[model samples]
Target: MATGTQPPASGTDPRRAGHGVRGATRAAIAPRHLRTDRWWLAPAGTAAGLLAFVVYSTWRAFSNSDYYAAPYVSPFYSPCLAENCVPMRHGPNWELFGGWWGLSPALLILVFPLGFRLTCYYYRKAYYRGFWASPPACAVAEPHTSYTGETRFPLVLQNLHRYFFYAAVLVGVVLTYDTVLTFRDEQYAWGHMGVGTLLFLVNIGLIWAYTLSCHSCRHIIGGRLRHFSKHPVRYRLWGWVGRLNQRHMQLAWASLISVAACDFYVYLLATGAFADPRLF
Candidate 1:
């Protein structure tokens, strides 16, 4: 019902008005797809190199000949520790290399040294800090203005980090169990290998706990904590978790140190430099 209002007279369609409005809007806002120099490569590279060292050193941990009788023993044996226990097997046994490849645990060594740096919220905030997670010689450069635009890969999956928290926590539990097991295994035949294996297990718990309790995980799972301080019950419970979340970087480094500690514990054992216990 047209009450003196004129309908479109010819070629111009009403939809054209909506398109024009959108076009004008796009012209007003600056485009965001800027290019930056890849300075993150340096730290990333160094981290990778160190990771390689961990892998190689881990391989050495498997050499059976490296396992020999401990040169000294304490006359006072501790059953709980499995201290003064005998070796699981005598040395010069290459057949044990496959089993010794317990070395793949070394592949994880890089996660402690390298991956930890990548997950930092502070690094995420600054280009200089962020580059450390990448490679060497990378620089802080301006955002690129080329604005080619998104070809694909929408970032919806980033939410999966919340799920990763579950995985990391589970791994922590596994590591804790491994530590508990180390004590059991060494009880029957305490040696360097037993103690070393236990140490690795303990470090696993440290790293996984650090990773699972990271700030990134908080963002992924905690949703937002802006007003929770007003809620007492929530503050009491969630506040505890947030404490770890706030100290994310510390946890990362702590985990890194613990992982190395774990590796050393076993490496020395594999070489017979120390004695483990016989828990069994």
Candidate 2:
């Protein structure tokens, strides 16, 4: 007999047998649970929340009786696309052109969320996380890995962010300017809007909060620069930024909710939901 016969099958030699069994089991059932363990859950949930807020809010906005597509016809739609867009006032709201969406207060606020959702770093995070729900904003499932392929329409909509950046900034300025007009209501004039100055202030606050918490901006502002820590102010700001970042998912969710809720109040005031919003 060979003296080296398989190392005599020592009592402590269970390792090989155990590993073989585990390897065989893994090989047999590995791919089945891949779908459930998908890595895209985080982003998916955040996006679902955003879309729910938008769609519900949009429906409410267009369905209100405070706006329409024509002038002085019960509730009226302010002519929006002309060189002479009227400041919104009392009007009936409804759809027109068969299924075309008519204008209203909801539409006004939608600009901010829609724009922010696209341009936001947090939203990008959500999108990257695979948001494992159904398709949100036109998506149905998270990709197993990176989405390197090219498609049109829905994919192309991502480009809308650049244009929406302009829109969001313009809207922010307009809303701020409207704030100025609201405080000095003693000097009101045509095409001037001063409603919800405080609410608009809230919107601005939310924007700054979201902007400062951004990953790109954070990195731009000493996040990536180690030497900047020598400066007390930079260090302090970075410290707070870090705090926000620690609860980043929280901040992202809260900021979106805050902006949307603030917008909703303004729209409600605009559509006469409340006699006058509690501006305090």
Candidate 3:
């Protein structure tokens, strides 16, 4: 018998074999990736951007103070679920979880939006490559020797993204409500508008864009339909969503930055850093 390399097992075709199939092999390249055109920059930049947001959000979430300014509330603290919340004029006092919950009111509601973004399909790909260095970039070798995919414990939770999308939609509605409240002046009159109002409007717009552009939203609207012609309204709506879906990554980052900026603007107002300029 000849002791030599063996071909793939009988009837097996390399092209048809799915990823992570046992005994799969690749070209033996000495370098991690042959392409040298600044591949590391993308993953590095992504990691830095995500990390900065995480740190800033963590700080703001825990700060508790400066989340509410007259006629404006931070996006991070909408719905104001704690009894100790600074009231927003014309805003619903839908406090729950009781006075016993003494933590930041932001903490009460941040989970839903955070979970939605955390489980976002684009985000999963972003962090997996950026933070986990799973291949880091295209054609790059990952340090992980074995790939279980999302079949394991924590990664398996990504399947709950669809449920999180529902929660995100509700959060968007609440943010819309909050933005509406910003239209009122300190006197609680309805006809007033400030710079904050415009900021709130832009923030809410981005939030809705990001929320509605979700892959889950697209699937829910259009998936499982056998015939597009049978549902013309749905087909049109699905087409709109499909266009937005192509820009999902951009919407995600835009919403993130806008939310933080809206919150920070309110923080400035709350801290008396500057007066909210009346634009009426």
Give the candidate number with the greatest lDDT. 3
Best by TM-score: 3
As a whole number from 0 to 100, the lDDT of residue 69 in candidate 3 is 82
- Residues 33-147, candidate 1: write the lDDT tens digits: 3336654564565456456545654553333223222321111110112222234332222231233233322233233333334334433333233333221232433354443
Reference-based lDDT, residue 136, model 1:
28
Error of 3 at 95 (Å): 1.6
Per-residue lDDT, model 3, residue 87, is 62
Q: Rate the local accuracy (lDDT) of all candidates.
A: 0.44, 0.48, 0.88
Backbone clash pairs in model 2 (N, Cα, C under 3 Å; residues 3+ apart or in different chains), count: 17
lDDT of 3 by residue, 1-280 (tens): 3544555568867564444556657644577678869999999999999999999999999887898788888889888888877666655567776765468888999999999999999999889999999879998889999999999999999999999998998999888988888878887788999999998899899999889899999999999899999999999999999999999999999999999999999999999999999988
Give residue 108's lDDT in candidate 3 (0 to 100).
Answer: 90
Q: How well does candidate 1 score on lDDT at residue 140? A: 34
lDDT of 1: 0.44
lDDT of 3: 0.88
> What's the TM-score of every candidate structure?
0.46, 0.52, 0.89
Off by over 4 Å in 1: 1-159, 189-205, 216-233, 276-280
